[model samples]
Target chain A: MKLLLIITGACLILSFIGDRRKTALGLKKGAMMFLKILPTILTVIIVVSILLYLVPEQKIAGWFGEESGFDGYMAAALVGSISLIQGFIAFPMAGVLVQSGVSYPVIAIFITTLLMVGIMTMPVEARYFGWRMALIRNSLAFVFALVVGVFMGFLWNLF
Target chain B: MRFIKKHGVNIGIIVAFSLFAGYSVYTDYLPGLEILKGNFRTFITELISMLPLMFILIGLFDVWLPKEKVQKHIGAGSGIKGSLLVALLAFMQAGPLYAAFPVAYTLWKKGCSRFNIFIYLGAFSTLKIPMLMFEIGFLGVKFSLLRIVLTMPAVIAIAFIMDRYYAKKSFEIKSLQ
Candidate 1:
């Protein structure tokens, strides 16, 4: 993030050197866009924070890990889609679960849905892609996440 | 009244959460609040460091990069080359999926095809370089490699489905402003 900010600042200076008015115009436009998106972004952030607080990540693995069947993949998929936690956190938690004997396919479903499908962020997505499009995209992701999981089961032959 | 209406949901969320947080503190309940604080710290860090820069970069993209350039590369006819480029762009990015939204929107506005946009989103979510490295560190290369192999085709399939689904539907990206 610091790197990104520094690069942006450097770019701004370069743009200023090239054309002051255009640089000003770009800044104004960006600020406006930022303000416009702020509310929805904040709302999503709060909702997600509260959710993580309430559910906790530990409980999520147990939802499907013990099942080791069709139902297990479904449960993991559902948990993952709903949680939508960051990869930084999710991957480590998943790694711990894997070490603890959670099936590879279950972890696959969990990780895929967690990353690809976001039930919580659908409103934000709908804001850009429209409700129907968001629904279709997420549905497709959900199905494919499951498919990915099933394929993992076959590839690993662990479950 | 108009302003409140405009931001009603966000205001409601903040006010309600604040009250709840205060009550939690007064009542000696702080686990949730503590978690919230941690999450907020992370969120604010990203907000401060990445988002504003992202917005301005998007602005620069808007001001400088022409629609024809985006279209010629990632639009309907760009095909496999476009998909590879989009994947590379997604791999280079280091932010969360939501941060990619505006960038994707900018690309869309600049004439990127629906297919490439979906590819960009999927690839951004899963194929990012730093995140991939982190995943490998945690999950091991074999597991991570299998995941990438499994996910790539799925992403492309979904992208194909999304493109075909939206191929006929006339739609507009809702303006938040």
Candidate 2:
């Protein structure tokens, strides 16, 4: 954590030193942009946090816990596929979910597929990569996500 | 009408994405489904917050970094540097790829190679700095770092495998006489 902070601090310092005026201008611009987007982000976080507070983690974990078997894995994948979350949001979300007792495997599936196979982002991918490529890529990604989940589950069980 | 014609596909795509997202938000069936509404709220907020910073960064990149320099670094001969470059770019970039279309298109038209473009697209899924920061803070650096490292090989492997097989296949099928 300290290392990460130091790296960020160094980068900031370097950028500041490299071009103070430009960096200041960029920071100002970024601040304005962030302010514009802040409300929506906060609202979503509040809603999700509310849901987190309301839902029973035990119930969720019981259903999709490591002991839940194949059913659990499938449920995880389905949830991930349906969510269509961007990668940025997915990891932290998965982390919180895992901390709440959701299986590591399940969280792994959620994170991998969150970016790999995007049902919501399909058309865009298709436009760029071709439908065949997109479909194949997403399918492969889905398969890999499952693989990742299973692997993580095994690791957790082993370690 | 002209505007519609120009943006027809994009508008359709945005609406379709919204509907699908809305459906999930409304369903609230899964364990986390109820969080959908909140996720939506935060998602838009983050997007708004990051968009300008990103644009400015893009502008800085545009101004300071020479296209040829970027191209060479990410292009065919770059090897691991290229992959790292892709990962860094992906880590730095925000927004879905759809939103990145104009930028990608512009770069492509500006003589960026197909290989680099593919790397960038692949990187799109992997590198997300702000998200990583949040995850590290919330989940612990080890978890985030492990996942990031684990994913690095996976993404790069996929890119390379696709590069070797799919790239050629697409070219053959499309450009054949």
Candidate 3:
């Protein structure tokens, strides 16, 4: 964080030397953009963190672990789809899920889909990629997620 | 009247679905209602904390970068080079798609190909820097690299398939009308 501040400060100094208007413009624009998204991103992170804090790993594992069946996979996928958490958060969640006896496949699928597919961000996706493309990509990704999940589960069993 | 007539069925479906969802949630059948209720305050507070930085970054992108430049570099007719460049840019880019949307919308309007847009999004979502770092840190660099390499082709393939097979269609099934 200190490094980031130093870099940003250097950039600002350079920009100031080069052309004040352009530098000012960039700074102003960056500020506005950051302001708009900060709330939502923070909301997502905090909510996900609190969720991580609250949800017992053992219970999550029980839903998706080795003794579980397709129902576990479904539960995992459903959880992945609904939560808009980042990989930073989700991967730790995956580790917890694994410790709880959740199958590797289920955790893998949950993590993959949680990162790749955005149930919450669908509207943003639709705006950029068009609705059809977003839907198809997400659905296909979901399917591949399942395949990956199963493969990983089987591999984990081998070891 | 004409607009409503055109979208009336879709509207009806959404309303009906929302009503059902609300009713179920209210009745406690949603199962995870506690999470929402439990996390509400903390979530909002965190969101507030992060707001200033997010907006600053967004505003900088908007003010510093010219839409024309982005479009020219990433636009159609640039082919594989453009696609690769878009991928790289998207990969290096930080933050969520929400911040990226203004630039992307400008590019699309200025005639960036559907394929490039798809590739940009595919790469952006999958190949984020923070994620790569985390994977490498925890999973061993080789395993992480392999996964990244494996996933790149998949992302590109998904984009290619969509471009070839599904680009022309609307999201909704026409039959619903």
Of the candidates shown, which would achieve the greatest lDDT relative to the real structure?
1
Tell me the tens digit of each residue's lDDT in model 3 across A1-159. 233345445656766787788877877766644444333343344445445547776665667767777888877887787687655445434443444466666766676677667778878767665676668878876776666566665555454
* Model 1: per-residue Cα lDDT over A47-142, one tens digit each: 766665576655544655545589889988999999956664566556555654577889889888988888999999889878898898889999
- Candidates in order have lDDT scores of 0.74, 0.59, 0.59
RMSD (Cα, Å) of candidate 3?
A: 10.7
lDDT of 2 by residue, B60-142 (tens): 43334433454444444345565566556555666665554454454455455555555666677655655555566546665
DockQ, cand. 2 = 0.21
Residue-by-residue lDDT tens digits, candidate 3, B1-177: 754565565556545545654775778854345444444444445334433333333344445555445445655534888787777667766555555555556556656676776677677766665345344333334444544554576677777887787556542211111
Candidate 2 CAPRI category: incorrect
Chain B only, TM-score of each candidate: 0.55, 0.48, 0.49
Q: Residue B65, candidate 3: how far off, in angstroms?
A: 15
TM-score of each: 0.59, 0.66, 0.54
DockQ, all candidates in order: 0.37, 0.21, 0.22
* Total clashes in model 3, counting residue pairs 3 or more apart in sequence or in different chains: 19
Q: Mark the regions of model 2 whose C-alpha exceeds 4 Å error after superposition.
A: A1-18, A156-159, B1-88, B99-118, B164-168, B172-177
Name the candidate, 1 or 3, with the larger TM-score value. Answer: 1
